[model samples]
Target: MASIQFKNVVKKYIQGKQSLQVIHGVNAEIADGEFIVIVGPSGCGKSTLLRMVAGLEEISGGEISIGSRVVNKLEPAERDIAMVFQNYALYPHMSVFDNMAYGLKIAKVPKDEIKARVDKAAGILELGQLLDRKPRQLSGGQRQRVAMGRAIVRQPQVFLFDEPLSNLDAKLRAQTRLEIQKLHRELGITSLFVTHDQVEAMTLAQRMIVMNAGNMEQFGTPEEVYSRPATTFVASFIGSPPMNLLKNAPGGKPGQLLGIRPEHLDIGTEGWSLVVDTVELLGAERLVHARVGDELVIIRTHEDQGAPAIGSTIRAKPREDRQHWYDASTGKRVGP
Candidate 1:
């Protein structure tokens, strides 16, 4: 386990007298055994940042350290980091045991120690029985487990996961997420996971870094990013169904934009008059898509709760003090 620190790190790609900056002077501190997830849309440089930490991408400026060692100049292998890729990247012909043991073998670890580590990781990932199977013989979830097992055997200072579950089905993704959380608890290895999925970041991260356009937008606990967004981009990006932002609405006070989560907006008889456009019943809950003033807002409610008919007007407001204010010009959060 190790504490990871990034001190004003920057990365730029040079192309024929032109330089495109991908990461702009980012700084962060991750405590030992902490799970940090970097999340953002594509082209936001979240993956680039994670690769830098793993020593896969060179830092253009500033420093990166693992534990007490500055690893900016260290080779990826010497950085003592294990990365699990999105594609799993397992050899097609190798058995699971061999795949997991390859790293330890290359490092020239004792055979007995390699056996011990492989067995432990396979057991933790519930892949022990499939150790003799090749990548072609396993399902997507199984293949993902092998990738994780490969990383665990290294017992590196930090574990890096680059969208490791994106290839799985929804059910498999959720189940794998639980498995990962359990594995993290069991091993307590410092982990940095990068994903574009807000759900994964919210569920897996003790802390999350939200990046946008080559810059750090917000870094905080999932709750902080959701409940009190530091920026409008964060408020919009971090939630499922996304937060509803209403501009120029007639309310208690004049505001540029009002942000509220779908779950917080209630179907009521006394608020902004909304023209119900659609109601999507989702088993235990429903997502009501409607128009409030000139803005589209989504309201989530229990499945038992009824929604107004299409083309009908209804009243809606936040269930609690869940409204957020954002500056119209800068898209930054303002006073509630």
Candidate 2:
């Protein structure tokens, strides 16, 4: 295992005479054996950053280090890293055992050692029974496991996953996530996973790097990012249903935005008066969508609380302790 470092890493695309910058200066230190997820929306450069670390993309400026050595110019094979792509890149004609052993065989490893390594990886991934099957004979989840097992047998210093769960069904995705957590616990290899799903980032990351428009928005634990976001973008992006950012909220302050989560607002007889617009039933909870002085706000309530009538005037109170303040002009957190 090895620690990775990014120092003012930048990426730019040069076409003819014009240059378009995609990745701004990003700096972070990843500890040895730590699992970090790079998350953002599509076209946000999350995958580009991961590709840079894997030696698959050229760095426009700054440097990347693996362990104590600079790897900015190293070939992908020389970086001692293994990559699992979104698609399961398995050999269709080969059995699982042969597919997993191909890398070691190409490297001229002893035949006996290759067998041992393949066997160990298969055991870890629970693919020992399916080793005799070809790629056509395996299910989607099984094929993905074979891909992971292929990576594991190489014993790389770092693991790079580029939205590896994007193709799996929802149920299989959840199951594979747990398997990955177990794999990391047992092997403890340094890993960097890239995805657009915030839930994946929150659940699988030891620490996460949130990216937006080629710039890193925040880097911290899931708790920190969710509880105290650094900017308005993070506050709105990290949560389900998103936090409400009100410009003309009650107790108005010029050039300031009041931010509050849906769960933090309580429906009551006093406080800000709002007209209910719509309500949604989501199994155990109900979401109240209301308008207050031309601004929309969503409040989360238990199903037992009963949904308010549409167009009915109601009062909802924002929790003083849970309120967030932001600078409307800059979209930045300003006060506690």
Candidate 3:
């Protein structure tokens, strides 16, 4: 296992006389055996940053060090890292065992050692019974496991996953997440995973990097980012229903915005008056979408609280300790 470091990392694309900067001076220290996730919306450069670590993308400036080596000039193979891509790139004709052992075979490892490594990986991934089956014969989840098994056989110092769970169904994605957690716990290899899904980042990351518009908005554990976001962007982007940023909140400061999570608001008799626009029942919870002045706000309520009628006027109080204050002009968190 090895630690990864990024020092003033930057990326830019040149088209004729114009240079478009995509990643702006990102710095992070990933400890040995830590699982980190880079998460953001599309066009946010999260994948670009992961590719830079994989040696697939060139760094326009700054240095990336893996372990004790500066790997800016090193080829992907020379960096001692294994990558599991989104698409399962297994050869169609090769059986699972052959696919897992192919890299070791090319490296001229002994046949006995190759078999041992493949066997071990197969057992860990629970692919021992399907080792002789071709990729076409396996389900999507099984094929993904084979891809992961191939990476495990290499035993690289670090692992890079590029949205590996995007292709799986919801149930399969949840199951595979558990499998991945187990894999990390057993191998204890340093891993960096890239995803646009906030749920995946929250669940899998020991620490997460939230990116926005070529800049890193925040890097911290899931609890920290969700509880106390650094900027309004982080506050709004990291949550499911998203944090509500109200410009005309009751008793609000003149130049500041008040932010609150949907769950942090309580239906009360004395507070901001809201006109209900819609109500959605999601399993055991209810979401009340309402308009407060011109701004829309969502309040999460338990099913036991009952749903309010559309067009009905109600009062919702923001939790005193849970409210977030941000600078209206800069959209940055302003107060403690």
Candidate 4:
């Protein structure tokens, strides 16, 4: 395991004499054995940053270090890192055992040592029984595990996963997520995972980096980011239905944005009267969509609480302590 550091890393692409900057100065410290997720919307540079760490993309400015060594100019293989790509990247003609043993073979490791390592990784990944199967013979989740098995055998200082769960069905994605968490626990390897899924970021990450258009928005534990968003972008992005950021919101001063989470709002007798636009009954909870002034507000309620009729007026209030204030011009958080 190793600590990874990014010191004002930057990336730029030159196209027809135009230099388009994709990643701004991104800086963060990942501790040894920590799992960090880089999450953002598509085109937001999450994958770009991960690729830079893997040496798949070049750094345009600043430095990246693994452990105490500055790896800015080091080749990918020399950095001692293992990567699990989204597509599994398994060879169709090769069996699971051969695929996992390929890297060690290329390095010319002794035959006995290679078998021991492959067997160990396969055992850990529960692929021991499927060692002779080709890529086409395995299910999506099984193929993904084989890809992970390939990486585990390398025993690198760091592990890089690039949307490794995207191809799986929803049920399999959830199952594989739990398996990855277990793997991290048992092996305690430093891992950096990149994905566009906020749920994955919140669930899998010990800490996470939230980005937007190449700029780092916020980096923290899921609780901190969700509870106290540093900026409007994070406030709107991290939540399921998203938080309500109203311009000239009720009980807010002019030129300030009032923010409140859906669950932090409640139907009450005194407060803003919301004109109901729609209501969605989720399994255990209900989501009510209504308009306050000219802004839409979403309120989460227990299904047992029932729901108001569409087009009817419902009174609601935001929990006093849960209110978030933001600067209207900068869109950054401010004191209430």
Question: TM-scores, in order shown?
Answer: 0.96, 0.98, 0.98, 0.98
Cα-lDDT of candidate 1 = 0.90
User: What is the lDDT of every predicted structure here?
Assistant: 0.90, 0.94, 0.95, 0.94
Q: By summed lDDT, which 10 consecutive residues of candidate 1 come out lowest?
A: 248-257
- Of 2 and 4, the candidate ahead on TM-score is 4
Candidate 2 stretches with Cα past 4 Å from truth are none
The TM-score of predicted model 2 comes to: 0.98
Whole-model lDDT, model 4: 0.94
Candidate 4 worst ten-residue window by lDDT: 248-257
| Top-lDDT structure, candidate number | 3
Q: Give the TM-score of candidate 1.
A: 0.96
lDDT of 1 by residue, 86-130 (tens): 999999989999999998898899999999999999999999899
List, residue by residue over 50-136, the lDDT tens digit for candidate 4: 898899999999999999999989999999999999989998999999999999999999999999999998888899999999999
Tens-digit lDDT track for model 3 on 168-271? Answer: 99999999998999999999999999999999999999999999998999999999999999999999999989999999998999999999999999998978
Write down the RMSD of all candidates, one decimal each.
Answer: 1.5, 1.1, 0.8, 1.0
Question: What's model 1's lDDT at 131?
Answer: 92
